[model samples]
Target: MQFQIENIPIQEVKLDFAKDVRLFVKREDLIHPFVSGNKFRKLTYNLAEANKEKQDTLLTFGGAYSNHIAAVAAAGKLHGFKTIGIIRGEELVRKVDSNPTLCFAVENGMQLKFVTRENYRKKTSEEFLTQLTEEFGRFYTVPEGGTNDLAVKGCAEIITENEKDFDTICCAVGTGGTISGICNGAYSHQQILGFPALKGDFLQKEISQYTSKENWQLMNDYHFGGYGKVSEELVTFINQFKQQTGIPLDPIYTGKMLFGIIDLIKNGHFAKQNRILAIHTGGLQGIEGMNQKLQRKGQKTII
Candidate 1:
């Protein structure tokens, strides 16, 4: 079966910023409520290949509040495939009812398997996969973060002829699949900037493995304390951004990327009259879970 995706729309962000810089966002988030943004793009061809291989099940890995886990569960349910999520943090097995992401995965008919963080670190190892295959019978494995060669191929489609005139493309990088694909699809004159959500020198190498393009660079300054970490300042920015632009940004990825982009623009990072396009790789599903955490810490929540 062919996986159908909507023609993502690019909307200009009308905000008070540098007068010479034009910023726009591609609404990849509007693709599907559950299987949205980069996840949908990453899964497009993978689902087709699974069907081609006659696979009846899809297995993947993620953490407690993983967007990939939720997306896979939704995709599997929609595509008529059984899904298994090998989740890190064994303690979360009992907290599934409270965790929005995991609860949604279960509600969508995904089987959840909780494992220690140590074992989760071995998710890509042959021994770990062999154990999983022996236990689960047969399943198509999607790497954690839903990034692979096919995922990159799907993400490359994000950059179309319409985006060719933009001077720079920006996106939140996780495992580097999205930006790598964007790099491959970008015009020679266009520069690609990736704002990683985590602190890592490893992503530079990870992205390189998928794309040989040299037009991309990673901005490491805006991680805001690493993966899954957020602050009151970021929450305020997100809330204000939504109120001003009518676009909701999850604190994990897109929010950080936008914060960095605007900061750069304010600091005179870009050349005058630069046209910047930011990819809104959706993880809005995670806002509820993040809000729950924020409430527990007496911190302000994402509105």
Candidate 2:
């Protein structure tokens, strides 16, 4: 299948925290109307590889509202592959389940299967694979958030095309694929900085195994909560950014990373003389109905 590439927008933001720090945001959120940004790179390249290898079905894992699953479902339907989303949690919903991101994924044609926390843990077990192979009839498995070699290769293409000399390339690290690719793709003179979306010491080893840039490092202080968790501060930052730049950032991913990078610059972690490039690995769909939810909690947006 021939996948379409999104031309995400790019803009430079000026910051008062440093003497000469200018941050450029590659607005990958604008990449696609439904599914966008890094998802394009993650899926496009892999699908091409699958086609080359003559694979018919694609299987992947994620939470109920995983951006990767949504993108894959959409991509698979457009291409000619069967896509299955092995959601992390059971299909249980608390009353106000307005997570537009997951809803969009269903609309795009994903077969959702809910599993218990313990069962989900066994998703990669030999027993699970054997059973799934019998059920799925041979499929290619993609890691959560599409963090794999092919996806990273696609990200590398993004850097080669940009050809900018920004001193630092900053992005939110969920699976570490995009940042790893940027580190691998960047010129030796630039630094590739990442803010973890999960709080744990393991992320260092996880990312280090994939990248070798001497200037690359992980910022551990930021993650509001582990994947899919949210907080008041994240909402505040998202609203503030949207008010100033008119971009919507879902609390689940990009918003948190962007908020942290700017804070780091303010705290003198980033050098004033260095230019920064921030990647917006779009997850806009997750923000659907976010305003109403926040309003119920009496949280007023910057807008």
Candidate 3:
């Protein structure tokens, strides 16, 4: 399966609180209808590898609203490959209404295999891998959030496409896929700071599982409330950012990463840095529910 890597332009803006901190966003959110951001970069090589091996099926893992799953499903279907989604959590297929992400996956011919939280843990185990291999027949496995060596290699290519000399590159760290790929490309010169969305003390180990970077960092302060959760401050800031810059940030991922970057600039994190390029790994639809929730509380959507 072949996928296109869209060259999203660099969007530069000045930081609100930090006078010296100049901010830029690589608008991966504008990459595609589905295969946006780091998702496209992460999947590019994997899709090529699958095509080289003549594999007909692409199998991957994610939650019901997983951006990774959304990307893989759309890419696979668009390129004439079968897609399988090993989704986390129990089967809510019949009980709960599917969200836009899940609906997109289904519309794109992605077969859903609902797994319990416990079994989902063993998804990468030898036993489960064997089962999927047997069932899918020489299927290509893309890990959750598309974080693998192949994905990282493809992500590294992003650096060459853009001609900028930022001292720091910041992006939300989810499964470390995008950040790892970025670090692989950016670690030699630029400082790579990953604002993680996952909780638990094991996040650093988890991040290192994907990339090898000496100058990389993971911020522990800005998770807000783990993956898929947000605070009122974040919701407010997201609203303000859109109003000021006309950019919509989903709270689960990019929104919080931006919040951390702003806080860092305010706290003197970018004092001596020349520039910071923040990767906008798109998750716009994820904010639909948040928009509704905030609207119920009388908060308006700026975008």
Q: Is candidate 2 or candidate 3 better by TM-score?
A: 3
TM-scores of all models? 0.98, 0.89, 0.90
Model 1 agreement with the true structure over 48-149: per-residue lDDT tens digits: 999999999999999989999999999999989999999999999899999999999999999999999999999999999999999999999999999999
Q: What order do candidates take by lDDT, descending?
A: 1, 3, 2
For every model in order, what is the number of clashing pairs?
Answer: 0, 0, 0
Task: State the TM-score for model 1.
Answer: 0.98
Query: Cα deviation of 43 in candidate 1 (Å)?
Result: 0.4
Please tell me which model should have the higher lDDT, number 1 or number 3. Answer: 1
lDDT of each: 0.94, 0.76, 0.80
* Lowest lDDT block of 10, candidate 2: 91-100
Best by TM-score: 1
Q: Candidate 3 local accuracy as lDDT?
A: 0.80
lDDT value, residue 111 of candidate 1: 98
Sliding window of 10 residues with minimal summed lDDT for model 3:
91-100
